[model samples]
Target: MARVRWWGTGLVVLVLLILGLVLPLVDKALGSGGTALAAGTVIAVGTERAGARPVTFTVPAAGWALDEARSSLTSNAEVTRGEVRVDLNLVIPLGSLDNRRLWDGLGRIVAMGGGRLPGGPSAVTTRHGTAGLTGPLAGHGKIGSATVFTKSDLGATVTASGPPDAYGRLAGEVRAMVLSVEISP
Candidate 1:
């Protein structure tokens, strides 16, 4: 007869328990593979130079100003109003990478950074192409939204954040900004 080992059983149980706790998170991070933007209308408020690169996009609100903007491996723009801050990031991959892959890659990076969309990743249409949206995740000093899109060799991410009260006030305009994003040639 084979002897039963309690420690072995306990170890197996522990591993299972850990997986049980982690599986949901992993599943959430992987997403449902269904793409649906949350119900809201994206509004376009204005336009500005997005980064040091010659690229530009529509701003969702009127008061935002470029505090600091630059370009390198990634082109980044930071806009601010009161305590609210918005960051626009653009990356032009030197090698071949398509939109879906680029979106997923950025999604994983966002998830690892503890930035989670309230509704997780979803499908949304941008000026350029279909993109992924995440958050309402926590940002530097407020709640924020992250949107990622890719076209040809370029991948872009926009993060908008502000104080909870202020964010609530500007939420619709912000959504419009996401909808109105247009990359300038």
Candidate 2:
């Protein structure tokens, strides 16, 4: 009886030791329960076509995850970190719309959705010299910015927003991510 008790105790300890060592590794591989993405992860959106320019961007820091259910297309992606959310979409303009018009259209779309773009568009360029415009987004008790980059008929729009505090906290990283966006021709 004494020997059996010792063996059972040893087996239990071994199982616990193994679990302690393996759980962390599993968490890392699965992105902390298979939702969060590690920092510096590059995400690609859009399908490969003859003239389709795909958009790709990197996660600026930790605590971001791909919201798979909300992201249902090759031309769009949604990522979230806490209360902050960033959405990227690839669009084809219906007609020849200049940068300013595109920005206005985007603002109108936001307003239709019960949101508003409160400020004028500001020029922003990507790392690869893609010219774009960004403007302040407000309404629905959240604050953010909307940026649009265009090449020919292809357009990439990025919107990042969250509650005031969370938006402020992640604003820098979010901006970096936006600046890091690249549209492959």
Candidate 3:
């Protein structure tokens, strides 16, 4: 009985020593791998055709994952941290439309109807061209905003929403992403 007890204690001590040494190494490896995955890398969002300047933006790899259900009409991704969920989308105008008309029409589509948005429509400009921005619209169940811009024959829209305070915090990063968008001239 004494010998058996000694063997059991020795086994427990060996297991504890192995775990203590291995756990810190595992943690360190994961920490560095996360930074390496996100470092200076920007994902391209848009079609790759003969000549198209797709929007490119960098997102932290740890908290964000690219949603895979995108279709021709909507190219999008999502990021979540704590209580906030942000949906990033590049909305393509359906069918064929002239550049001038599309630019003009953005307000109508985003407005949805009069009295829907807090401040109605306002003129805005992006790296690509002049755009219409609207919302944090009323009755949307969440704080939200939309930006409409054009590139060559394509029109793009970005909509973002979350709890008002959290959404406000993300606004700068969102704008930076939008500004980084380069449309082929």
- The TM-scores of all predictions, comma-separated, are 0.56, 0.77, 0.54
**When superposed on Cα atoms, how far off is each prediction in RMSD?**
16.2, 6.6, 8.1
Task: Kindly list the per-residue Cα lDDT of model 3 for residues 7-121, writing each as its tens digit.
Answer: 8889999999879998888887654221222433455556765654355445533454344443232255554443344444554567764434553464466466541445645
lDDT of 2 by residue, 46-159 (tens): 886675437788998887888887885587888998778899998777888566877888888998999998868889998878889998889899999899888766788899
What TM-score number comes out for model 3?
0.54
Candidate that beats the other on lDDT, 2 or 3, i.e. the better one = 2
Q: What is candidate 3's CA lDDT for residue 32?
A: 27
**By the lDDT metric, which is better: model 1 or model 2?**
2
lDDT (Cα, tens digit) per residue for candidate 1, span 68-134: 3222323565655566656667666778766556656766776787665456567777655545554
Full-model lDDT for every candidate = 0.60, 0.84, 0.53
Q: For model 2, what is the error of residue 21's alpha carbon versus the real structure, in angstroms, after optimal superposition?
A: 31
For candidate 1, the per-residue lDDT at 34 reads: 24
Residue 1 error, candidate 2, Å: 44
